[model samples]
Target: MTQTANRFHRWFAEPGPRPPLGTWLMSAAPSTAEAMGHCGFDFLVVDMEHVPIGVPETASILRAIAGTPAEPLIRLAWNDQVLVKRVMDAGGKTLMFPFIQTAEEARAAVSYTRYPPQGVRGVAAVHRGSQFGRAPDYLKTANDQVCVILQLETPEAVERLDEIAATPGVDALFLGPGDLSASMGRIGEIAHPEVQGLIAHAARAAARAGKPIGIVGPNPEMVGGFLGMGYTFAAVASDMAMMTGRAVEWLAALQGRVQAAEPAAAY
Candidate 1:
């Protein structure tokens, strides 16, 4: 495959003048992925962890995203080497490994993305990551270019934020606001002041360790709060949220029109 800069990795290593913003891709639709790519997001998370989207479907979504400027960062169901290998071979330059509650799990996640000596990923010269045997130095350079983002979903993960952020080969840290809040007995209450405080604290820990942090929220307001808290990258919403939100608005507006018409027709 032909070689190109890893946009996600570049942003993490040296964020430019503007903050990078992204969105979640839980729709599992290539059209949806492609539409989001053109909507000016800096990146997108192809959510495999909870979306029921498998590797094959992810590849199609990735392909759809490949046509646009926004880069794709896939979240795996787990930090297993097999899953990492499959995602990497399927041409995912950035991988987000979720539910990593400890530094050791974080380290293992990093290892799963790299080849032997640096990681445990098996070499595959003929893989899509190598551009189907086209990226001449893929084997030599893939390790350096592939970005690893570990997730923080529980209180335990937050407590170990410093160590996890400092782990070698971890390109960045992503906070999962939903699960983190759920773990705190505030299920589905990411905006709960206590949950927000924890997220802010995690941001501080990551910043102190000199690591970049990323996070997601259901809407722009919540995501904006996260951005204000020193998160380098933030995802404001998901494909599902955007789609259904607009659909709901449409129904409400149409209902209002019908209600107004009924009153006028009573004459």
Candidate 2:
């Protein structure tokens, strides 16, 4: 079979002058995914970690994003091999494994994305990932197209960034501010100076390891700060966050509590 380009992998392998920006999709709605795809994001992450997006729903979401220029990334709930194989067969190319704390866990996450002598991903003769058996040479080429992104969500994880980044098949690194803050005993305080300090340190560590790093924040301002700290990619909030934030703002305006401001552009 012919090889398909994995843009997420290519973007990090040889980054452009501008860092690619993305957003999270927690609604698990195909329409929402399609709409976000058209909004000019470099990539869109279909969140399976926090949201109830099963394999079938994930397949539908992939179809929704296929027509747009944006790349689709799947954030798995955990570093489970079974979960990884299922989502990959459902057409997930770029996957983000969450809460990884050690080099061994990082290696396991990468192995889940590969098949045969390289790694152990269960094989299937017919599946969406193989174009339903149409891609005769998919087995040989899929490994090259798969992108593995490991999430460092705790102080321990951040401290081991160098070793984890050194693991083969780890295409990129993502620092989860929410979980990291909580792990640092600063829950709901991602902007706390201590948490922010570790974030900056992780970025520099990733740069030193010669790996591209990514992060997500609750707003553009915070994400902009991450970009300035040497993050190669960043995601600003999610569809649900933006929608609810606007809803609250408009309701406050209607109640005369405050004036509603113009909608901020979603990166």
Question: What number of clashing residue pairs does each candidate have, in the order they appear?
Answer: 3, 1
Report clash pairs, candidate 1.
Answer: 1-131, 1-134, 1-135
| Residue range with the least summed lDDT across 10 consecutive positions in model 1 | 1-10
In candidate 2, what are the lDDT values of residues 97-184, reduced to their tens digit? 9999999999999999999889999999899999998986898988998999999999999989999999999999999999999998
**Could you tell me every candidate's TM-score relative to the true structure?**
0.97, 0.94
Clashing pairs in 2: 1-137
Question: Whose lDDT is greatest here?
Answer: 2
The window of 10 residues in a row where model 2 has the poorest summed lDDT is 258-267
Off by over 4 Å in 2: 1-3, 257-267
Tens digits of per-residue lDDT for model 1, 116-161: 8888998877877889998887888889888889999999999989
lDDT to native, each model: 0.90, 0.93
Pick the TM-score winner.
Answer: 1
